[model samples]
Structure formats: structure tokens, C-alpha cells
Target: MHIADLQRLITRDPGRPRLTWYGDDGERVELSGAVLHNWVNKTVNLLVEEFDAAPGTRVLLDLPPHWRAVVWALATWRTGATLVLPPTTEGSAVVGQEQDRGVADVDVVVTSHPTSWTGTSAQLVAVPLPALARRFDGDLPPGTIDAGSAVMTYGDQIGWVEEIDPTAIAVEPALRHEDLVTWALACTPRPTASEPRTLVGEDHPLVVLRRTLQALSLDGSVIVTSVASTTAFADEPERLDRLRATERITD
Candidate 1:
């Protein structure tokens, strides 16, 4: 199913809770389907109508792992842009075997820092979360985005890539259950209860993980990709403890 289809489901059932944002203090903010849909709509309007973002246009997203990422990602997909994510914000040169899989080529870069653009030479724009928050009075921006386009990370810049043809993108109507089934089949190969160290790698383990969780009929699960360094020290016991403690609130 396309991202728009998923958004439509939420719009149809606005009260259904779909996302839970956890804080370091164990505080949580629940994003109900209806509320999330509205937020996405606002965000879509801001990006598309306000900024003139269109399908196949790349929009850089430099924000952290907030609920906004999820919403913006869905909106980008619906609009037909290929969403890009930078490996890190420190502006390190691409290195190691994992660099190839980190950031894909794109036309725009979104960064939190207005100065110091890094990584690619794409158009740079800063989406200051604080400024945005103040602008909206803590509410998400306004508008609905159609899938078929995507919002991805460029380098440290944020703007639009106009080379893509919006007319070529399409959104499948029934993607949820079908995607669930696909995820179930893919995640079944991993050892579920093993030490966390084994899970960290330059691999797409979550693809398989999603499949496994789906098979169990689990309604929700957070899959942490190995970007967290603590999992590498799982054998050290204390290190793993600290890492686990840090992530426990989200779990």
C-alpha cells in the first residue's frame, strides 16, 4: 500500500492511536490516527503549497527521531519523492564498508544547523524544530501530502530537487495487510531472544525482524537499527546495562 493509503486509513479513523513518542524521563506522547493525519495534512500543506514541493522533488529532513519523521516520511512517499537520510550530523567523510548504504544521492539537504553544511552539495535549508514549534504554537503545521513523492535526507541542505517527473509515481490502494505479510515473511529468519550484540551489523536485519514480529501477530514493536553503539558492548554487561537503561523508556 502507498503512504497516502495509510494516511487515509488514519483520516477515516482519526481516533485510532498509531504512534507513541517516548521521552528520556519515560514520558510519552501518543499520536492518535486522527490527530496524526491532521498533522500530516498541515505538514503537507506547508511543504507542498507553501514551499511548492511536488512529486519527485527531494526534501531534506534533518530532524531527529521524532514522530514528525514518521509523518513526513509518509507524506514524502505519497508525493513521489525519494526520502534521503544522512548517516550522521558531525559531517564526517563517508568511510568504512557501511558508507555505501548510508545516504543515497539526492537533490536537497535538510539540516538543523543553519551554518556548516556537510556531506553532499545539494541545496541546503534548515528546519529549526524550535522555530517551527513556535510558529505552530506546538501543533504540527498544516496540509495533506499525496504519496508518490518522497521526503529524504540530502547532505546538510534542505530544499527541493526538481528533476523527477511527478506523473510517473503511483500509490497502491491496499498496502497495509499486504506489507504486514511481507514483513512477517522477511523477519522470520533471525534469532529473537539472542544477545543484542548479534543483532548489530551492516545488515538489514529489521526487514527480517518485521517479518518475525508480524508472524507472532504482535501489534507493535520498535526495531532499533544498529546505529546505537551500546549494543556492540553487550558482552561488557555494564555497557549493555547503560544502553538498555537509556532505551528502556522507549520500550
Candidate 2:
């Protein structure tokens, strides 16, 4: 299945919560299919209009498992741009590999922290992690795009989509655009689970992205905790239990 196909399925129940996030600072946010789509659409416009991203364009997502990070993934696929996560960031925690050697061909870098843009020549798009943030209040690096705030200015509906090669790599770990949905669906929950409501405690953005895909594949939902709050639910068994019960988690 393709990204558009998954999007159609999501909108089938637009109001049903698709992803729920808990931040380190005691912040909580929920995204239904409709809401998620809106964010993704806005981001798609940003990538396409700002950078002319399309098939073969490589965008490096350098943020953690925040809601904006999720939107980046969705938008990248929609644009048919290659989402070059750092091999480990590319593959690990934030789904990106770090350093100049790692991102040799990256055309754009979307990051929350741009310590020094000198490390890479890729266009920088700085994002703030806060859910309600109207903009990135921090001092932005030279030639940086405050995407967190610019996202609001972009048209919510995607202006267009590129027709990409189905065989082209859409995500890392060699996931092709055509095979992504099937790959995600293959990540089935345990046999006893039904309408799986997954709990992703890990802080890795790759883990969050993978779980999100798995939940969608299973026609399930997910509850994710941010990097700072990984231990929030774990430290309180009672609270975790209450959360599970409230969300009706099957696995």
C-alpha cells in the first residue's frame, strides 16, 4: 500500500484518536486522523514550496519523537522526497544519523537543535518541540527557516503531490514507497490483542515512527511519551494502569 492509501483509511474514522502524545513537561496532546492530516498537509506544502522537494530530493529529519517530527515523516512521504534519516538517526533515537560524513547528500535538515549550522550546508529548518508554540523563540541560525511558526502560514491543504517511482526508497532501512503499507501491516500485535492500543515508552523517534506505522497497519492506536517523560508512566504503575484502562489498550 502507498502513503495515500493509508491516509484514506485514516480518514475513514477522522475523529478517532490515531496518536496520543505525552511531553516531558507534563504536556499532553492528541491527534485524530483529521488533525494529523491537516498538519501533514501543511508540512507537505512547506517542503514542496520552500524547497521544491520531490522524487530524489533528500530531506533529513533531525528531531526527536515529538508531534512535529511525526508530521515530518508523513509529509516527506507525501512529497515523494527521500526521507534521509541519519543512518541511526538515520536509524536510531531521532531516526537520523549525525555528522557531516553521515548526511553527505542531504538536501534539507529539519531539526529542533541547530547547535552550529557550520557542520552541514543543507538548508536548515528549525522546529520547536512545544505543542502550542506559535514559533521558535530561540535565536535561529543564519539562513534558518523557523518551520515551527512558518507551518501556520502555509496552506493547510497540500497544493500537489509528486508521482514517484513505487520502487524508489521512501524511508530508511530500504522501505520502498509501494511496500511501506504492507511492511507496516506485517508488524502485527500479539495474537490475543484486538484493536490494539499500543504504549510506546521508548524515547527513540524511530521507535515512535515504527510503532505508529504498526498501529496503523493493525488498525490500532498508540500512546507515546516524549523524550523527557519516558519514565513518567513507568514510575507510576497505578497511573500507567489507569491510562491503559482509559485507552482500552489491547496489547
Candidate 3:
């Protein structure tokens, strides 16, 4: 359901906004269903054409609660690669616990902070979180790909598709393609997914990721916060209220 579900959502309503992101730096980006599908396709091409990612490939996602993270998730799934999400930002319980794990531990490292991966063999794809940016913010390491720019050059339509087994593991935490939507729905509790729900929240990174997937699977929209809402909105009540009203974040 991972790839097929996304295709259906984009086809059903190409112009409806699917993802609305809110960054800690006051950045906001809204991608319609078609736009979201394009990003996923381009990233899928980037992974398959540039990085040679395919089934059984393990791609590590080292990112915060951002829109690109969602894009990477869909793209990784589209390629039938295992999405390796470290339980903790540093390192935690992965399927195979390595003695010393860094960003280099996986086949590809998708992150904004690539400095942590020194002398690593994995393909580093540096991503800039800003809404409008051509490349990653500073000097990226020698071999790192500037994802912001590289993704733009890729074809908007997915050129090829891999035959994904419904039972194959698509994510690190042992989520299979057949059960991905069911698992995500369990993590995110909000308005029924059948309607146009615009959910906003501050949850764990994994939970937030799951929530985004749930929204996509169920034809809903999501607004994720870069920082926990409590922290980012602590000093700005009016800002919070305005956003809630604008996005129709009703309980």
C-alpha cells in the first residue's frame, strides 16, 4: 500500500494540498497532492538512478520532523528499500545492532548534518530544510550530493517501478508494505481519515513520521512542527492561534 496508496491519493485530487509544514524558523511549505507525488518520484529517481538503490537497500534517514523527511520516506518505499530510522538521533536499537554506528552505517545517509559522518562510506545526501534553497547551507563534504539541487534535475515522473512484495519489510522497525498504513493509523489519532483532516501536533519523530504516512494513506493533510509545539509556540500564542485558524486544525 505504500507506493500504490500514494499514487491513488495524487490521482484522486491532484490540486488538494497534502502536506503543510511549519519549521522552527517560521518556515511554511504546502505541497499539493500532485506536488507531493512529483517530489516522491524525483527522489525515487535520485535514489535509483544516482545511488543505485533498490530492493534490500538500506537507506538511513537522519532528519528531523520536516517535509523532506516525508518525501524521502515515500521515495525510499517506492524503491522497495528498507527505510532505516535510528531509534535515537545518535544511535539506538536497530535490527542489527552495530558496535559503533554512525551515519556511514547505512547504504545512503539522508541528512542535513553530514559532518557527523566522517570517513564514512555511505552516500551522503545533504538536505537543506529551508523552504526555498538551491543547495545545502554550507560546505558539504566532498562526496555528498546536494539533494536540494540534484532532486530538481531528476524526472518528475517515476521512470520505473520495482515489484514490491506485500510482505517485504519496507521500514526499519519491521513495517511491511501491506501493513504500513494500518500501523501508521494506530500511531496517529485524530479526525477520521475519510474526511479532509488537517492534523497538527508535537510528537516523537517516529510518531510524527507515522502520522504523516497515515495522512497520506487516508487522503488527509498534515502540519508538522520542526520543534515541539510547546517549545516553538511558548512565546507566541497569537501565532499559534492564527495558524490553527488558517489551517483549520480543529479537534
Candidate 4:
């Protein structure tokens, strides 16, 4: 089961909201399957046309656990590029630091920063968050690409791309396409027709990725919150009431 296959499955239900994200600052973002797929397609075209990304290409995903991160991950997988995550140190809450040396191993690095980055020798792709705000205030660095601006010019559909191998390495830490599909299927709970199954969790890559996959696998929707927000809403009764009042969460 390649990432492309999962995307195809979700795209069949284009009208339903597949992912809803809430930022720490009360920013709300909702993407239907078709919208998500359109972003993925643009990303694929950006990586391929600009960075010459192809099968076996290594892409360093240096972004936060925002919705755009999920878009990059799926785009990388769909392009058959190996997604290399930044190294994590034990007991450290921060991830995807710019100073990390892991970027040396990849061909291109995609980051969620407003300005250009000079931390790595690899080609840079700055993917600004918030989606709507101005990307950069000054001139971008040489050899750096602004994904936010470039993606808009690309076609919304991925046309004439090569077929991706399901056995290819999709992510670092030894996760393959087939493995991800199996895991998502196993973790996805059966959803009722009345309400969509929902998951709330901290804005960390691992948590966001897993929950997003599970929701997509079961044709459900998710609500993403920051760690601080999760801590603030820890009381069980209040949390339960809030979830119930929303009338959108099944789990």
C-alpha cells in the first residue's frame, strides 16, 4: 500500500473534511480530501520540477507538526522520495532544530520558516505556515526556493508522474509504505455513520502523523491541538463535556 494508494482512497470522498487543525493561537484550518490532494500535488510538482526529486531521492522534512507537515510527508511519499526526519535527543521536547547535522545526508531540506535558512549546504525549500500570510519580508537566499509562492503556479493534479513502488523506503526509521498502511488500518477504529471518529492530541510529528493516518483510514476527521492546550484541558469531565458539546467527535 503506497501513500498514493491511501491518497486515492481518501480522494474518493472529496467533500468530507478529512483533517481539521487548531493552532495554539486559535487558528482554525480545515481541509477536505480534494483540497489536501491538491496541496499534495502542488508539493510533488515543486519538489520534482525545482529540486529534481525522484525515486530514491532523499528529502529532509524540517517542519513542525502543523497541517503542512502532513502535506509534505504525503507529497514525499507520493514522489517516492525518502523522508528523513531530524534527529531527536532524549528528554528534549523540541524537534527539527536548524542546527541539526542530519540535513547533510539529504538532497533537499523543506522547512517551515518565514526567512531563508543558511544552516545546511543542501538546497532549501521554505514552506511558510499559516498558508495565507506573506512568506518572506526580504530577499530569499541564493539556492533557496519559496514553496508557498511556487506551489501556487504548479498544476493542482499530479500528471504523468511515474508509478511508485510500494516496497520502496518511504520514511526514515525504517518505515515503508506497506508498513504505514498496515499500522493505520490496525489503529483505525470502526466509525459510526452518525458522527465521525475524532482524535485530539499534541502537535508533535509522531502523534499528528499517526492520528491523521488513522482518521483517514477510517474516513474520519481529527482535531489537532498543541501540547499546552492539551494540558490546559486535562480535566476529564470538562474535556468530555466539551467533546460532547461539539457533536463532531465520536472517539
lDDT (CA) for every model shown? 0.42, 0.76, 0.76, 0.70
Task: State residue 234's C-alpha deviation in candidate 2, in Å.
Answer: 1.6
Model 2, 61-89: lDDT tens digits are 88888777878988888888887666443
How much does candidate 1 score in TM-score? Answer: 0.50
TM-score of each: 0.50, 0.89, 0.88, 0.82
> How many steric clashes between backbone atoms does each model show?
39, 13, 0, 0
Model 1: per-residue Cα lDDT over 1-251, one tens digit each:
34455555555645644554432333345666666666666555545544556654655555454445555655554455655555554433432222364544444554444244443545554443321232212221122121212232122122343333433332222223235334443553443542121221222322323432332233332323232332345446785566547544223
lDDT of 2 at 98: 43
| Model 3 ranges off by over 4 Å | 87-105, 228-230
Order the candidate numbers by TM-score, best to worst: 2, 3, 4, 1
lDDT of 4 by residue, 72-158 (tens): 888887888888876553212222354454444578878765243464557878777763543543556676778767888899988
Query: For candidate 3, what is the TM-score?
Result: 0.88
lDDT of 3 by residue, 74-185 (tens): 8988888888875574422332344344323478878878776545567789898888587888877798999989999999988876767778778865778788888876
- Which ranges of candidate 2 are over 4 A from the true structure? 87-100, 188-194
